[model samples]
Target chain A: MVPAADNQTRSENETKWQLGMLLSRPFFSIGRAVIRWINILGAATVFLFLALVKVFRSKQLSKIVQQLYYIGARSTTIIMLVSVFTGMVLGLQSYHALVKFGAQGAVGTLVALSLIRELGPVLTAIMITARAGSAITAEIGIQRISEQIDALHTMRIDPLRHIISPRVTAAIISFPILTTVFDLIGMIGGYISGVMLLGLNSGVYFHSIQANVEMKDISDGLIKAIVFAVIVATVCCYQGYFAHMRRDSHGAQAVGLATTSAVVISCVLILVSDYVVTSLLI
Target chain B: MNTPLIKFKDVTKSFGDRTVLERVNLEIYEGEVTTIIGLSGAGKSVLLKLIIGLLKPDEGTILLRGKPVSKMKKKEINAAFAQMSYMFQGNALFDSLTVYENIALPLLETTNLKKSEIDRRVMARIEQTELTDAVKKFPSELSGGMQKRAALARALITDPKIVLFDEPTTGQDPVRKNAILSMIAQYHRKFGFTAILVSHEIPDVYFISNRVLALYERTIVFQGTPEELEDFDHPFKDEVIHSLEALQKELTGLYSKRQFKVLNHAQMRRRAFGDTYCIAVFTLEDINSIIRYLGHDAVQEAIRRMGLYIDKHFGVIGGFSTRRNTNEIVTVLPYSDITEAENILKYFVKDFQGLEINDIWTGVRRRVAMAGPVEFTILAGIAQGQPIAEIDSVIDSAKSHQKEIWTATMRRRGEKI
Candidate 1:
């Protein structure tokens, strides 16, 4: 079979230019692309399981330890910083609003409720986007263009298994613990503000925080945070994975574009997801 | 053919009305280094992409180890890519990662290998490609040859069963070219992988890859052993051999003068001192086929198209255009040296060469001459410095010399003086 040489050339030319827009399009429907998304999701799930199997088979405790540090131990600073700031802001806003009705003491319970219900999870989501999201997106995007993804495929190793799954699982596991820490720190900020800044009783502040935040609220916030974590991680991985699909195959700019796009998308998605979770809970 | 490891059966792909690949069938056996050789835009790269599952065949099937590529998921298809290594013409290394990181990336992503194990394996590959010194540097920091080596290191890091080299010798100096070829040969030896190389570096690639597939006229015009290609005995084979000989002659005679023997009185102005003249055609590889393909019409079209493309893009062309005929235009550049003429010819000739025809029917091709995608190739030929006052014999000499080289089936190297 022979194709017309000129026609073949022309088609190749068109494909090269359209490559960017075509590759980028998956970002739009991939989440909602039902069958495609499900296929990818199911495969991703299987890939994760396979990786876990390999890890167990190989007895790779060191890799697991390194991942624990990368996902959990190293993220503490940003996590703590986000929670404290969210706490202080919640304290200041609640002070003015509750005091206007001569109910300034409710600031303790209000801060706890806000942090457990929304602020802790939402702030953690934003922080992780800046921290974990950027690292994962950039790393994978570099791999995508560098053909490391292709290299993995050559080695008969599903890149989704060792590369994407670990990060995704790490995010899911880490975000809840991170959100719990944020929730605890945020309440402490409320307690400090109430005791020192507002001259409220420390006993009352701590008691209010402890009683106001229930297991259900904590559980719900943790669940939402975990979901947001998965979204951010997966979106970044997807961006990086599909980066090579571009014909022009952007170099550094592609990585940057993907990371920025992932961040923006993840941030927006986190907010939308937050609303949905809050509504369902109420 | 012993149950080919890979086979392309009537595979055709089109983008809208323009077709990239058409019902193309090819069989690649295991353990053979098959080189696909062709000119730029000949769809060699597209073929590689199709086999790697980067693109799908719109018409037929690509079987790998008896499985269809079109039916595989990206992961499954991508899994096949694990069995292969592809070297891009651009040496598309990750700009952000250090060389070590680039080599270690596949292991980190795909294998359950520990960091130390990945590092150890990467170090071995780096050593294999002699990129240990460059391990810490990014792709930008390395020299062109070193970057190529690093890219090769990255490709071979995972020990793929098949490797694809895309214009591997392009942009490389002769030394670097040979080194890369031998490096590829070495990897092919150690891994026993089937190497599918895409390149125009025939003299170099022909040594390593036993089988050659020449993509000409959208068909496999030449597919055989190097001996078969040398003795191809077909008109097309003659063209290739003639081309190689001509190119070699062109390069070696760069500084040598061409003695022209003026035959008739009409060519009198071209000589000096007597009925003899001499001029050196330093660069012809870039412009010779072009002249043959389009004739004089191509030259004028090149000049005009160059002017238009320059206005649409960026480039400066100021010279004289001699209207030899309605279709043939010869420009005798003044004030500019021979090199400048080469540069000028490179830019304006594509439109004249019929290469730009694709741009008209399909809006997909990047006019790299305009897009800054690549710098244009430039070459120059120098005319003898004999004064026009005694020029008859000089014109005769130059003309005769040109005739001799043009008529000779093979290049005559030692006929000087």
Candidate 2:
């Protein structure tokens, strides 16, 4: 019963609407993802700020020390183990490349610089994220679901002060120290591969590291470590602390998901921040 | 009238699209035990959280002592919080901390008390909670009951004027559940603190509660004294309360009324045309007086003990029992005549009389001292019925023939019965 002109107009309008929806869907998805990430980042920043404000609460020293033992001291063995293998591989590869130009002596310089400037902080952070960071997330997630955090609130105790601040403080103290250990142990691992196994001059290896390494490089690496520590601690604690808010899961499953997300996000943030810090400092 | 201690005025709370509580209005008086009863997940805990400012309402106001909590300054909120304590549904004892450390944490964090004072208070609480042996153990290392006690000890350590208990006896056995309720009642009387309890321990909680708030369908459906609640007619009463009673029957190892009918039907199906059965109704006489002189807890214990004795004697003879009401147990002995039932009833009476039911009163006596000796009697009535007979009529006949078969005069601990 419709007129030709009216039918034509309706068809054209439908086509336009369909085309518009088709074109805007991707933008809509991208916008949604962007907004979600922004919300997460904003929430994490607030959580970190609140925790930092309560870092100096009464009797916080003991809690921080305990976290240091867990995040820094307990992780030392795994850090050392991974660092040795990584340094040995780096030594073997660099030796092979440098010996092509009769420049194998520079292997020491390359190993020391690479580990001190980049590998030490990045590898140490990733390893700790797998070890201590996941544990923190799971622990806090369990506390969240089990109402321990609510219990703390009812007791008039700030959970951020009691739980998160100590871990964050410990991370700030521990990361740089652990990174320094990684550098030292990794360089020794390079020595074992370059000098002891490949017959490079031991004196040349030590002298090259001594002569080429600068305080700026060490400080830059330490700066990266500190940044990585903050990112990892904040992301992990935020994930666990708000696990109960996750819509996709509940209870123990939520805890597990939070732990996984914490580790993944922490490692991503660590590497991404490392690059940014390195670019600024360089 | 005195002003309410905490009042919720047209409060509404929602999570995402789901509205948990809608325009909920309730008042809690000071120095009285108020219990919030409802179906699970009906926002009872949400109401408690609103009172304590753990969760803020999406609309309206929560007032503490006539002052709005949301409008209170930080110092005012802190002062208000200092007078309150909450025991969570799940005993949220910190797993990493030892019992002693857990109990001592609040004092250490909130107060500048001397170490000796903290130690004394912590040790006293631990001893009172009977956690002295488990003081060094972590929460994970303790039994479920022990963890609950530990959590209770922690909640009470601050000696707050207002205590919020969220299903405090959820995972306990009947005996332990009664003990915990008694403990709360005793403490409430001793400290004169306002106790706000969220519980599913029906009838038991009603005894200790001065006011009962029934949360149903996302609002406070009824709020009044326990006696008033009993008389208040609402779907919540038939749905939540009756369902809980049914659940209690299962928990207490007795059949519910419906279950008893099904069982009786099954018994009838197995019976021959000429075969007869006996129905006996055992009523704990003077229950109202027992509740008056002794207490609800004592009457409950007596009923439970009677049910157990009935089960023990009749269960082996292919008989089953159901709690007919608050003070009566109905037993169906299949394929047994009146004489046979009478003989079994005599043995039951003898065994029950010798059962030393006074042990159940020991804990109650410590709290409530009696002026004179109170005697408790159980009256039994038996009636013969054919398989085709109406169960109601037969039960009525048994009730009409009721006579005292056993009596016990509650005496002093060392006095002869």
Which candidate achieves the best DockQ against the true structure? 2
Give model 1's docking category.
incorrect
Highest TM-score: give the candidate number: 2
Give the per-residue lDDT digits (tens) of candidate 2, residues B1-417: 689999999999999999999999999999999999999999988988888879999998999999998899999999999899999888899998999999999999989999999999999888666677899999999988789899999999999999999999998877567657766887787788999999997766776899999999999999999769766888988999878867777667777665677789999998999899999999888665655455444455656666876877799999998876667888999979989888988887776666544543454464332334677777999998999999989999999999988666765431336
Candidate 1 lDDT, A1-282, residue by residue in tens: 566998889899999879977887887677567877587668645644554455433424455566667877788898888788778878888888888898887888999888888988898878888887888888888887776666455445556665776677677778888888998998878766666787877777777767776788888988899788777777777777776554444788888888887899889989998998889877
The segments of candidate 1 whose C-alpha lies over 4 angstroms from its true place after superposition are A1-75, A244-257, B1-5, B15-18, B29-31, B52-56, B63-85, B88-128, B135-141, B154-161, B186-193, B230-417
Question: Stretches of candidate 2 above 4 Å error?
Answer: B249-417
- Per-structure clash totals for the candidates: 33, 0
What's the true lDDT of residue B265 in model 2? 93
Q: Tens digit of lDDT per residue, candidate 1, span B1-417?
A: 589888888888777787866767788889999988766776898888777766677888999988887677878766677678777777777676799987787677567787888988998877666566788999899988777777787778778888888888788654355457666766776689999988765454666777888776555677787657755556655555446534532322211011112121234454344332223221223232332222222222333343233333222333222111111222233234345544554554444335553332122121111111211222323333333434334323323433111111111111111
Q: Residue B87 of candidate 2: its Cα lDDT?
A: 92
- What TM value does model 1 have? 0.61
Each model's iRMS:
4.5, 0.7
How accurate locally is residue A171 in candidate 1, as Cα lDDT from 0 to 100?
78
Candidate 1 chain B worst ten-residue window by lDDT: B407-416
Tell me the lDDT of candidate 1. 0.64
Q: Fraction of the real A/B interface contacts present in each candidate?
A: 0.28, 0.91
